[model samples]
Target: MAGAQRSEGVVTVVGSIHVDFFIRVPRLPRPGETIKGHGFAIKPGGKGANQAVGCGRLGLPTFMVGRLGRDFSELLLNNFRSNRVSTDYVYVDEETNTGVAFILLSDEGENMIAFDPGADYRLAPDDVKRAESVISRSSVLLTQLEVPLETVETALSLAKEKGVTTILNPAPARELPCSLLRRADVVTPNRVEAFMLTGVEVRDVKTAVEAGRKLLSMGAGSAVITMGGEGAVVVTSEDAYFVPAVRVKPVDTTGAGDAFNAGLAFGLAQGLPLVEAARLGCVIAALKVTKFGAQEGLPWREELEEYLRKGVLELTTPTRV
Candidate 1:
């Protein structure tokens, strides 16, 4: 939770490491269409790695529990260490290859991505079992959907049994078993994920509430729905509030959501209420889109405090959408 205004506690990020290949194109090609690209860049990235860096920059003692291929193992390990995240629990394997993401961006920052999960898919229950002590003492556990579902289930199960607060960021939307929801203290899902989880289209706050209610019924303690450009909605059994976003020209939207999740986890780990955590996350994400790259864009604790101190607090009263 050190990423928010407060600087304290250990936050563990359990996920993947990926090398991203990006290209700027005139437009996304159709199934049979071919187009020329105008630019290219290879960046060190991965959602899990990005979140860990975000947490580390915010000043928390962070640890990453994941697997990487021999080719990129040392590079990814150094990435975490350079970011100040502990790499004692990270592992390298000879059989699997590191993950990769091929991304296409337009001049305006809108983009498309294709991914090869690689070693991420091979993470098993035993991988998590190896870090029981480090994870048990942590204030929070951060995870995403880039790896296998059973692996996620195992991590959540361990966190739940140990009574550490658990947060799940369900990205690249997928339908998860309802059983998994029981272990989550908070589930962060974007509009697309809300739709998939509840069988309802989330075009507005009211719709988000309906979808959130359905997810809570399925066993999650709370559901936070993030709406890009518009804002975010936090729904719990006790209350619901909508936080509007800062309107800014986005350079690239790649890691905005992950930055937001990092903020929320940091806030919650520090004992903030659900709505307050979401508010911190909203502002952090709004700041993230002003720059490019997932980890590069995340604001440090002082920067975030300055943003708020500069009287940038603007909360819109939401009516439906």
Candidate 2:
């Protein structure tokens, strides 16, 4: 442990930033069918915002590289500021609408989502590169698929060139460019997204390993497939690890994966190895599910640590829910 250099802290998240509106209903409607929800409310959220909040809540010094419209820029800024995440790189646009996500959560805690990129589409390589300069100072950089592919490509390349560890949370399910995947130190994908990328139906541990291995072999340095209550499966070039999920009565699973990624990045920034980082991430995500909304569900550093210390944890990752 003493032979090499030690480091701490993370720099920034370069991706989609937006506001989230959550609607809770008794059951999800069939395709082309409409159903009424019991309640609805707006919350501060987005892959970038959720992850940024997760990092900040973990006591990491974090920043976000994103764009937003004037209508909601101040609100988003206030959310990050309140969480102590640096907002120096956040910019407001007059022409575009602020990014927003309309989410539907079932009483069982599953969710459906529709999002508008708004000013998130306006983010470009120049924006990410500018953030990269600042992010390069930290131990790790976290990126995601919510922003333009070109912008993400630029940030990942820049980070790799600087020998910085880069973590990519590939959400919304799409085929990622091999070049971009190659540049990533870690790729975190939910179960459905993993199937989209690798054609592996990740319903069990064996299948999860198969999917994760294929992804790592494709280009990613490592692959982490998040299987909701089944926990997370991690694949490195040389080995594979499975960190089981925690069992808390499910309230809302939205942003749970983002919370996990933030925890992993937070642990890695503090010099923890990949496996332990994933474990910590599992804890954070498990805790995230105990609440509703994306950002609202994310726990603060003290709260998470307090729960961690109690050690009354159980792995809930079954083959099926």
| Top lDDT model | 2
- Could you tell me how far off, in angstroms, the CA of residue 152 lies in candidate 1 after the best superposition? 0.6
Model 2: lDDT equals: 0.84
- What tens-digit string does per-residue lDDT give for candidate 2 at 205-321? 778889988888789999888888868887887777777888779899999989999988988888887877888889889888998888777888889878877873345222221
List runs of model 2 lying over 4 Å from the truth: 1-7, 312-321
TM-score for predicted model 1 compared with the true structure: 0.93
